[model samples]
Structure formats: structure tokens, C-alpha cells
Target: MADVTHASNAPPAHLAAGTPPILELVNIAKYFPGVIANENVSLNVFPGEIHALLGENGAGKSTLMNVVTGLYQPDAGEIIIDGYGTTFPAPDAAIAAGIGMVHQHFRLVPRFTVAENLHLGWSETPRRLSGKDIEERASALSKKFGLPITPSAVVSSLSAGEQQRVEILRVLSRGARLLILDEPTAVLSPVEVGELFSALRRFRSEGGAVVIISHKLDEIMALADRVSVLRQGRLVGTHQTCDVTPDSLVTEMIGRPVTLATSYPRQSPAPAGGEAEPLSLKQVTVRDAAGVVRLDDVSLALRPGEVLGIAGVTGNGQPELAEVLTGLKAAESGTVYLNGKAANRADPAMFAHAGVGHVPEDRLKRALMPGLSVAENMALREYDRPPIGGRFSFSMAQARKFAQMLADRAGVKLPGTQVQIRGLSGGNQQRLVLEREIRIASHVLVASYPSRGLDIGAISAMRDMLARARDAGVAVVLMSEDLDEIFALSDRIAVLYAGRLMGVMDRADADRESIGALMSGRNLSEAA
Candidate 1:
């Protein structure tokens, strides 16, 4: 794989004199079974720069990176690293060439300590290095980046934010010149993002180059020197970070204008009619497995035509509340009213019967049956809908038709209803969940991370569905860690800090300043 120095996709006359880019690609192309993942892609990563690889879902950003890391081989392309032309047979080859990648999911052994995990490439006496020596180096590296990670700390006991920081630190320990991170901030709270970016700045100071593939445009704009866009397997264009606006980036990736609009079609009765209350929770207190109180004396109500966004650091009892609401988990002490009806621990079956739909926060944990067929997954969501059953008998024919219609509505590209859901990508699986939950026209809806792994197009569709649910008078609670998502679709916001309810704010009152502070333990009007 020789570097194509005389490439013609762009002007060849001049590339200003400097150290050759740490990594370069020329006319790279990769193909999957039924899709062209990347086509004639050319990319360059300069040393000491954070290059944002920008693209929507299915835009080949991941694919291109996979090729670079040798997780997948491109059918046609040339890869040049630090002036050395080479072909890699596997990820170890990329690692050998001073390239390291930290996937969105940190690929670390949870049970291992920080030092032990990072030192897995070597034996106990490799190069006559002692355990104490490795631990010392690990400790020093953590301090260099101001990461505060302890070499002896167990990975399983650390928080998600801490784990992510350790992943970055592990890659740096390898002396890799080029680092690649995919959706690095998806799980972090806004404050954590700031901390993580600061560490990356330290890496930049040392002349390391970073190629970040992410969906959050604001973060990209904040940290990147230049942005490259991929659309439908092609390189749409590249934009200088200073010259491109959010609107232009969206246009480039989507190939059209996009409005942040949500619309759901249906005329379901609002939470209340002329003079009634839709749903209410009174004095709710939830405890975890360790007999720890999660929600403390919480009380709230949901009305028709309202989108209530729940924002907080994860593990702040939001999951408990969602479970209690959906009947997946019973509240320790609380009373729930469903459209003024007594909603007790009648099981999830009762929630479905009472026109309540739930999309759990963890898709694999509670939301989906991965081994089931796509049709079966869709059918399970609407077991109570007419034609399928009348609380008496189920109809297989109705289930199949309803499932197919929903499959299309949700934008899952399965070959047929019989296709196993696990075969679908994360984006399509999310769509399957959305369609099933939204199709029943329920009065109260609970959607947790509704657009969790979807691309831009899928996210737009989901936001539209939630807005449509609101417009049609469904009381909707959207639980999310992505504040941008909550900001865009929420009519009002509530902050959950630790195990307490902070306070509620209207859309006009919420911003990064207010929410970021709330997520952290700062002084605010709402106490938690």
C-alpha cells in the first residue's frame, strides 16, 4: 500500500512544508455485504492537532477508522504513517505502528486494576520490568495528564467517567502518536466532558494527533482544528473549524436543511379532559439493592401536551424512577395515578393494558429481546392493541401485520419480519423499540434514551415522534444524559442530582451554565 503522493482528488501542486502528517490515506474504499461503507476516502491527520471526523450514523466514519485500525481491511486504498508506507493485517499492526484506538465502549477488563490492565501486553518479567516499575510509570502518566487515576484502583469500582479517562490514559501509555476515539462523550455529563477535553489538550501539547469521531457537533467545534464530513460512503467535504457553522455541518452531512421539529400524529385524549389531572406521583421514595435511598420524598405530575425532560448524572435514581413508573421495579413507598386511575404494583402487563408505553433506558437490559425476531419484538409492545387481542386471545396474523408496519415506521432495515433483531445494528434496534412503544397511542409515555445509538436521521425521527406524542396529548417523560437532546425536545426540565430532585425549569430558563452546574454539586436554586 504505497502512499499516492500525486493524488488528483484535490490540488497536488502544494501541501505547505511541515513534518509529514502523522497519518495519511489516499482514495480508500471499503465495502460490506450490502453496503458501500467508504468510497474513495482521503484523510490526513497532522501531528499535534485534534481532527474531528464528522459524519452522521452510517456515514462511514466508524468504517474508515476500523480500516485504519485494521479491524477491517479496505478493498482499495493506501495508508501511510509517519512517511512509512505499510499495510496492516490486524489491530496489533496498527499498534506496532504507533496507532491506538479507544472505542466508544472502553475495551478493558472490568475486574482488572488500572496498572494491570494497561500492562497486559507484557509478561510479569518482560524486559526485566518489575510490577512496581510498571505501576510507577502508570501513576506518573496519570499525573502528567492531571487525570487523578490511581494505578491500584480497580476498574469495576470506578464511575463511567473515570473509566473513560482511564481508557484515554491507557492509549497514551503506549506512546502512540495518533489516537482515535469514537463518541467519547456520549456517556459523560456536561461537566465530565470539560474535564476529559482538558486532558486531551495536555496530549496535544505533547505533539500527539487525535482523530475524534463523534456526533456532538458543539464538542467538535470546541475542540477540533479542522472537520471532515462523510455522507453515504463518500467524502462530502472538509471544513475549517472556524469557517463552518452548525447549520452548514448539518447541511453537509444530511444533504439538506433540517429543523429541530418533532411531530406525532394521533388524537388521543390529553392527560386530562376539560378539568382533570392526567397522572401524578406522590411522596415517592425508592431504595436500591444495598438498602440505599435513591429517590427522596419525590412528587411530580405529568399532563397532556407536555414533554418533561429528566436530566442528571447517571445512577441518580432516574433509572429507579423509570422502572417504578413502568412497573419493571416496584417503589419502596409511593402512590402512582395513571390518568387518575389507581396504578399499583399490577405488573408491566397492567401498564400496557392501561394505555401506558415504556422504552427502558438500557435497551439490552429491559427494552429488547435480542434473540427474538424483529416481528416478535414489535408485536410484544402492542399485545393489548385490538385485532391482536382483547384481553382474551392473541391473533398471530394481526401481530405480523402490525409488526411489519411498525418496522417500516421505525426505519429498521431487516430483511423480513422473521429476521433476528440481534442482526440489526444499534441504530436499527433503537428504531424497533421506538415504533413499538409509539404506535399504541398511549396516554402516558416513558422513553429512556429513545434515540440512544441512532444516527442523525434516526434521532430526528425520534424527536419528531416524542413531539408528536406531546402534540397528541400524551404525557411524555424523556430521560437522557445528553443535555442537548433534553434542551431541544423538552418543554420543561427537571434535574436529578444524586438521590434528590433538584428543581424544575422551563426551556427558556435552562442552559449549559445552569444544567452543568446542576449535574455537578454546585449552588443552585434547586437543592439536591
Candidate 2:
């Protein structure tokens, strides 16, 4: 057990003398088959407060919140809302009791109009409603919360940030007094984040309580009024935001001292002029299966030993750009060059043979085979020509040995090589993918959102690995929404907007203000 002080039922010191908490968890515990998800954990959320929940991956934050939202029943504990004990048999029951949760992945139906999506599962709403009636209601709620949205607009046509606003509006429309947001800012740009924070502040002023689950320490520090740290299924502590620092919260979350790197010092500068480009794209145009252009006239060159960071808001052609580079998708027009040779129609196998490695955005869907053993997944790239495989025979022993060595070297924590890859946490799975890709990438590597869902410690480790790969002369194309990560690792930053390359700037010339402007589809001069 960690050195933690158990929270008592007494009111928090920072709250008004007699104001009770809007919600309280008294000694919550949840158990699974051979797993203790949470134990004797207690927390409090006051009215009009933004309480942040901080923890590493698999640290019981989700379990506790699931209990609160009625997705899971606690083995032992009491949930109190407004000074009365209650049991939430289901999510709807919780929502009816003034609690609502907005998941990281929006639950809206993309094809439906905003008003139609908001009325989904709304028992209080009439089964038959006029479009105007629902739109008017949704508009009123949006204005009340300071969240702007087009009630008649189709959800699919909205931007990532706008979609998030719809999700929040849906929750608020349910008569919720307490709102819980999970990783709400994960996909938004800096400007959108500011807008969200402002909306949340307005909600707070209206006496609505909020509990935010986030991995970014800076966001938590900036937005939270109180923060609670969880570690290994126990409540470490809860303190007022003014009473704690980010470093202190980090120490409590991981139980160690980890200095997160804000900038990576390059071991050597990238090779300069006249060095043949490892990979280049010239006037490349790509289209989706539906014939929608996703990349338009984009040109880029990847140099030896450089991290070319791709920055953009989500759905602005980052995926298309990555797919074109990795040979997963073909360019509709123009050319893709590998070492000055036009390899326009090259397939994934050809890219692999040419020493190109890819860490895709959706790792589970695109990178790893969840049902397979760790060893099998680890050796997936080299199975055909390795000690683990012959022309007709496969060596499980060699495969296990090879995987064990890589796991140890990459600091992936798992029971054994025979365990299913799905059993490991997100961070460990990512580490496995990165280690395998780095080993295979001799010339070029394309990594997209490599640290998106990882904890602070895992994020630091991932950044170090990318830096080491760059040092080893791999031309890295890192596509990320995180400006900090981009600035830390990128020698040059490329901004993409609406399938067009807005501009590319050297790290020395780029700042958040400029990058954010470009991300929102403004040129440098317009930004100025």
C-alpha cells in the first residue's frame, strides 16, 4: 500500500463552512476475477468545482468512475448525492439522479442531426417531436451553457471540437447537476481547448459540479479546483488545486520521481543540403473510398536524422498523409519517392522491404493482433526470415526468447511471452509496437499519436525512444495533436488543414500561437 491518508466524511477545508459536497464516495471497493480494481477509495466533489482525477493507466480511475456512472456496481461502498445515500442500478438511473458522463469517444450518431442526437434515449422527450421543436430546445441549452452548435447540422460534418460540444450539451440537457468528462481535450486544438475551458467555467459559475479525467498535468493544473490522485486501486490524497503542484501530483500518481522532458536535446543536427531525401512526396493527392479528397497537393521531404513533426487538428488529413507515406494507400495523383525513385503505387510489403516502419494511429485495429501471444505479435514483422521461422518450420522457443529480450529492453511489463497481447495495458502494447518498429526501421519511420493515451512515465519513455531512433539516422514523420510533443521532438513542423499543407516551419521559428493559427487553417500572414 502507498503512504496515503484516507479521506474522512468531514467536509473539505476549502469549501464553505456548511456547504456539503454534491457527490461523495465512501470507501469504494471493486473487485474482479483475480484483480482488485479499487479498494477503500473515497472522494468528494463539491458544487461548482472542477475536480481532476489523476492516475496512470490501469490505476482504477476508470473503475471508480464506472461505479459512479452505474456502468459497474461496487463490491462495497456508499454513493451519496446531496447528503442522501443511493444505489445506481444502471447508467440511466444515475443520469436521472442528476449525474451525467461524457465519454472520450463521442456517443453521438454521426449521420443524425444535432437535435436528433440530443433527443436519443431521452425519456422525458415525446416520441414524436417536430424538428423545429427539438432544434429550439437544443439551441436554448447550447446558449445557456455557452456551447455554440448548429442544431440542424449533421454530426458527421462537424469538427472534432464541435462534436465534443454536442456531447457535453447532450449530458447537460438531461438535467444533470454533476458532469463527468473523460479526456475531453484529447483531440481539440489549443484555441478549442480555451473555448472548452471557458464553457466549463460558465457551468461552474452556474453551480454545476465537474469531474475531469485527464493525463495532461498542465491542463489539470490550469482547470481544476481540486485534484485527487489514485494509485494501484487506492486514493492517495485529495487536495485543493491551490495547495498542490504538478510535481507533487506526479510523485503521488507514479510513486517515484520522474522528470518529464519538455524538449529533447538532439544528439546531432540533421544532415544538411545535398543529402538525398529518404522519403519525399511531390504534389501528392489522395482520396478515400467514397472519392473524397483527403490530401491535396501536399509536398514534403524527410531528411536523414530528423524528426519532421506533422501537426493538425483531427480529421484534417493526418491519417491520409500517413497512409500515403507508409504505402497503405496510393496517391491518386502526383508521386511518392523513396530515395529519389518514384514509388507511387508501392504496396505495404514494398514499403516494408524498403525499410519503412509505421506506428499507426489505431494500434489495436491496425498494428497488433490482440488474440495472439505477445511473442507472436512482437515477431510479426520478421517472422518469415528469422531464427523463429524457417521455410517450413516455426521455432516457438526462439520467438519467446526474442520477445523476452525486446520486452526487457523496452521496459514492457507483462507476465510472460505466452500471455495474450490484449491482456497488456495500452502503454505496454505501444512500447512493444515502438520497439519492433524501431528495430525494423533503418531509414524511415512514420508514427502517429504515439503517446496519446499513455501516462506521464510512459510518455517520457516513448519520447526518449523516438529521440533515440532519430539519433540512429531514421527519418521520422511524427504526426501528433500534442504541440508539446511536436515542439520537443520536431526539427521542422508541418501544419495541415482541410487536406492542404498550410505551411512548414523550423522549430526555432515556430511557437504555439503560430502553430495554432496554422492548425485552424490560417496562413502565417493571416495569423500575424
Of the candidates shown, which would achieve the greatest lDDT relative to the real structure? 2
Could you give candidate 1's per-residue lDDT for residues 1-528 as a string of tens digits?
A: 132222212221123445468888889999766667899998788777788887777678888998999888889989998777788899888887879898876778889888778787733326765768878878888887678787888898777788898888777767678899988887776678899898787787788888898877778889987778888878877655777898888888889977565333334543444544466778888887779998887888876778889988887888887877776766677787766876757487777666678887667648778788776777776666687776888877787787788877766555567766755556667777876777654677899877765567778877877877787777789998877789887877888877677777787787878877777756476432
Q: Whole-model lDDT for model 1 versus the true structure?
A: 0.76
lDDT tens digits by residue: candidate 2, 332-393: 99999987899998498788878899999878868999899999998888787669897787
Model 1 misplaced stretches (Cα beyond 4 Å): 1-16, 121-137, 261-279, 312-315, 338-350, 362-404, 412-427, 451-456, 481-488, 504-528
Full-model lDDT for every candidate: 0.76, 0.87
Candidate whose TM-score is highest: 2
How many Å off is the CA of 225 in candidate 1? 1.1
For model 1, what is the error of residue 245's alpha carbon versus the real structure, in angstroms, after optimal superposition?
A: 1.8
